[model samples]
Structures are given as structure tokens and as C-alpha cells.
Target: MNESAATITKPTPLLIELRGVTKIYGSGAAAMSALRGIDLHIDQGDFVAIMGPSGSGKSTCMNILGCLDTPTDGDFFFEGVEVGRMNRDKRALLRRHYLGFVFQGYNLLNRTSALENVELPLIYRGVPRAARRARAQAALAAVGLAGWENHTPGELSGGQQQRVAIARAIVTEPRVLLADEPTGNLDTARSREVMELITTFNREHDLTVLMVTHEPEMAAYAKRQVHFLDGLIVPGPNQGGDA
Candidate 1:
């Protein structure tokens, strides 16, 4: 083969994957299946939005992806490492070093300054105080909150608080961002602003994004959408998030 042929690229592997994954709660007559041997794979730097109605299993899947829960059967792989084989501490380390999350409620401490809240994850990682403070400041600046870092959550507007939450999520330069209804609490204008910031990060940082949102407008920001129904991923466009 010529050198050019030798340089041809290979198909990229999945950044995250699930194979025949299942999750069942309780047992016997009281059992509830949250995922029924579902298979999914996500490429790095892709943004995917997950949508489903109540009891449709989207949240359960999100919990598993976030490492907050384990599948009852099958396997989950992250960067080709079988997550199911990892002990709790290893999983925690993976989450700490690679995953970032933003929630619908903005999940910030009511009395903490925005900068301090952004520094919380670093604190858990044992980052030195000075470095954490500097990184937190930089993250706030990236999210357009530079001058407002010292404001407490209660002192900030809903949009501002959510910005702080976004700042905190990205402060670690995490590889994947998991956002659940990130704009749920904001007005239309604020929601647009937040989405714009997220989109910029995905484009510029090449951050892989997995978002869960029932609102079609919010999900529209994603590159694609995955619909869930009866514990399995379904084909076609979203079914309007109705179970």
C-alpha cells in the first residue's frame, strides 16, 4: 500500500456507549423496568438531546449516564473503559475529572458567592485555593459573569444564577456536559442567551453535550434528538414528549 493509503483514517470509536443495558427496580410483582436492554453510542463532540414523557425512562437513563446509578444488566463503556467494572471510587474519579452537569433548577448554594460556587468542584479535587480561585474567575468570565462573581445566588437574577451554574459546570474543562432542562427556569430571552453560550462552548471547546429537555425549542439547540418510549430508544423525531 502507498503511504497515502496507509494514512487513510479509520472510523472513530464511540466516546460513550451502552450495550444491552437494562435497569430494573424492585423484583417479582413490584418490578419496574427503566431501561430494557437499550443500546446507544455517542461520538465525541456531538450534542444530543434526550426527550421523553414522564415514566418513559429518560431520567433513569440520564442517572445511569451520570454514574449516579448502575444498570441491572448489560454494560456501559466510557472512552472504551467498561464503567460497570469500575469500583465506586474509580467511577467517582471519572465523574470528577471528565463529566460536568447543569440542572433545571440551577443547583447553586443560596448563600454562596457565584465564584465560590464555581470553585466547589475544584475544592473536591483538592485544587489549591489560589489556583481554584483563578480558574473560577476565568470560568465566570467565559460565561459573561466576570463582574458579578461575588453576588450570591439570591442576589442574582434567575438568568444570572443559571449562568453561574454553567460557569461551575465548565470550570473544570470537562470533556462531557450533561444538562437537564438547562433553560427551564428562565424566560424566553434568558433561555436564548443561555443556549447561545452553550452552543458556543460546544463549537469552540468541542465539548460533547448530552442534554435532556422536554421543550422542543430547547432541544432544537442540539445537533440531534433521541426519543425514549417504554424504556427503549425509538426511531424518528420526538413524539412530543408524551408517554
Candidate 2:
């Protein structure tokens, strides 16, 4: 099938599926299991929050779901394609085409302007200079940073810097956004502002959001919430968790 035709024939609903997923570190009796038989599915356009306390394995699960790590056992399927068994190069290609990430630290290079930071992903994707700049500018504009593209991270407030990071994450318009403690370092008000932007992106753009957070209020913005304990996910309140 041609590329466009092949894409058109793919299933539309389920975006991510993990079956009997497990991660093990070390070896012999000293080994540690991160995720224990995780079976889950996340649909396209769904907003989900994964909540847990420290050492609950949520981080491992998030890493696996984001294609940052592969499971020692079990299978991972993204858009009906089995990715867990893929090699590193294949996984990297999938990540470039399918996922965007936002993390706690802004992670912007000090010397780079906001626009340049946002353009990094496109550069990796082999987008041309002119088109990459245009798309980066539009993404910044979407995040309300139109005139501040020339500003470096140091010149911007914490909130503005975070927004710039968000713009960078969304610039590619990937199928899924994996957010790990996106607002953990921000003050309450700034946290709210960032959350509003994330929710707005999910609501209006149909971006599939899978966010890992320890805060109950942050999870409340998501349509579904899952909590992890002792490396297993258990049923919990939609937003707030014991964490």
C-alpha cells in the first residue's frame, strides 16, 4: 500500500496498548520489578493521569509508555504496531513520528532562543530550515509567545519558560504527549497556568495526553486517572489518589 493509503487503513481508536508489561532491573534475587503485569489501553484523544507515590513504579511505566525504555517482558503496541520488540533505531523513528514529551525541568539550552529550542525536534526530523522556522513560530504563537521567540530561557519568567517548553513539545503535533511531572517545580499559580495550557491543547487539538503526576489537582484535569502501588495499578478515584 502507498503511505497515505496505508495510514488511512489503520485502526483509529486505540492509541496505545500494553499487555502483561513488566520491567526488571538487576539480576537473580536482587532484581527489582518495576511494572508487574500491566495491561492497559489508552484511546486516541483521551486524557489520562497516572498517579502514585515515590517508588510505586509509575515512573517506569511512564518511561515504557513513552518509548523511552523497553519492557523486559510482555508486549507494547502503538496504533496496532508491536513496538516492544523493535530495535532501538525503529523505536527512535516511532518516537519521532508519534510522541512528544514534556518533563519537570524546562531542559532548554541556555544559549538557544525560545524559537530555536522549539525547532530542535523539527531539525531532528529533517525538516528544512524555512519550514521548520515557520512551524516553530506558529507553535510559539499558539502558546502565546509570539513576540518572545528571540528571548532565551534566562530572560523569561519561570512560567514563560515552561510555556516555551510546552510549545516545543507540541510543535510537531505528535499523536501522543507524555508529560512527566510537568508542573512539579512551579508555584501553585504557575502550575495552574501550565495545566490550563495542557488541558486546552488536549481539548481543542484532540491530543492524546498521558501525564504522570503526584498531585491530585493536576490529575483532576484528565478524563481518566490510574493509580499505581507496589508495581501494580489499582482502581482509584478519577482524579485524586492516595499519593
Name the runs in model 2 displaced over 4 angstroms.
1-12, 237-243
lDDT of 2 by residue, 1-243 (tens): 113422442344787999999999999999999889888889877889898889989999999988889999999999898999888898898888888899898888897899999999999999999999999999999988999999999999888988998999899888888999989989989999999999998877778899999899998898888899889888785534432
Candidate number achieving the greatest lDDT relative to the actual structure: 2
Error of 1 at 88 (Å): 2.6
Displacement of the residue 72 alpha carbon in candidate 1, Å? 0.7
TM-score of candidate 2 relative to the true fold: 0.92
lDDT of each: 0.86, 0.87
lDDT of 1 by residue, 1-243 (tens): 022322333443478999999999999999999999878888777788888888889889998888877889999998888896577898888889888999999999889999999999999989999999999999999999999988999999999998999999999888788998899889999999999899988877777789988888988898888888899988746344221
What TM-score fits each model?
0.91, 0.92
Clashing pairs in 2: none
Q: In model 1, which runs have C-alpha deviations exceeding 4 angstroms? A: 1-13, 238-243
Give model 1's TM-score versus the native structure. Answer: 0.91
Q: Give the clashing residue pairs of candidate 1, or none.
A: none
Q: How many backbone clashes does candidate 1 have?
A: 0
